[model samples]
Target: MRHATQLARISSILSATLPPELAGHVWFAGCDGPSAVILTDSPNWVVLIRFQQAQLLEALSHILEVPTCTQIIVRVVPEGLPNGYLTQR
Candidate 1:
């Protein structure tokens, strides 16, 4: 529950950092070591997120107050699935 709250907080911060055009389409997934996982509904958004990788990392590091936030991993998850569906599978 704590981790989920933290992820949600991070998601809110990162969502605000995104371009207005891309805001709702991208979301925080989870963190793997120094990498921040991100999820999007489309492949096109993956490329767009990559374009903002550096900025995203910067924002993440600032929020977490850790320079170790070094990588952003973006994955495509189809929209409208129930939460936790991916993990269940």
Candidate 2:
């Protein structure tokens, strides 16, 4: 339940921080400890996200009022992807 709350808060942060065009395309999937996972449809979004990672993390840290958010895991999901999706390193 705590994790759910945390992710929801993070989602809010993402929604506000992301650009107008990129806001709704990302979904907050879940998290393990301090690392949060997000889902998006394309690799281009992932690249854009990577470029904006620092700002997102800063926003999250500011909103959460702690340094709990240390890493972001972005998973690209496509219609024809394999049963098990692979996240970029």
Candidate 3:
């Protein structure tokens, strides 16, 4: 499992690498707990990504090799540790 910090890095990379059209149309939004919402001006293209976590990762990997994200959600673990650690444990 990857840490939120690492995920943040991944998100950043993903955000930056998005195609110009996609970049302008898409904006990553609020971190509501473990899930964060992605806002889009072009709903059509974004529809492919809106609720698919796997798609998000796929898009990120294809677009940005190492980009900084605009926003991210860091889910907290019940044991007062980061969720990443909890998952690993």
Candidate 4:
């Protein structure tokens, strides 16, 4: 439905919005209300991006015109796991 489209759009936007240094290391996990969740390949990226969250939110808000995101939640995948695969954490 409408929410599904919104989520997909968010994921696409995030793929392009992440910093080059962080690109390919993270992905859009999903959203809750206006909070956007991102999962990274490693804890290093998680810690790095968490400090840059304000800029990230700003980047996303610029690309997002509807179903606005109000927050960013960054998480790390389990060590030794592959990237971009969804799993219960």
Which TM-score value belongs to model 4? 0.61
Leading candidate by TM-score: 1
Winner on TM-score between 3 and 4 is 4
| lDDT score at residue 31, model 2, on the 0-100 scale | 56
Q: Which lDDT tens digits does candidate 2 get at residues 1-89?
A: 56555565567667778997787666666656887667777877898777777877787677667877688888887663332222211
Off by over 4 Å in 4: 1-12, 79-89
Local distance difference test, per candidate?
Answer: 0.78, 0.68, 0.44, 0.65
For model 3, residues 1-89, the per-residue Cα lDDT tens digits are 33455554544555565654554333444345445555443436554444344545456545544323333332322234324422322
What digit string (tens of lDDT, one per residue) describes model 1 on residues 1-89? 56666676777788899999897777777778988888888887889998999999999889888777688898887765336433322
RMSD (Cα, Å) of model 4: 5.2
Report how far off residue 16 is in candidate 3 (Å).
1.3
Deviating ranges (above 4 Å) for candidate 3? 1-14, 50-89
Each prediction's TM-score versus the true structure: 0.81, 0.66, 0.37, 0.61
Total backbone collisions, model 4: 0
Model 3 TM-score is 0.37
Better of 1 and 2 by TM-score: 1
Rank candidates by TM-score, best first: 1, 2, 4, 3
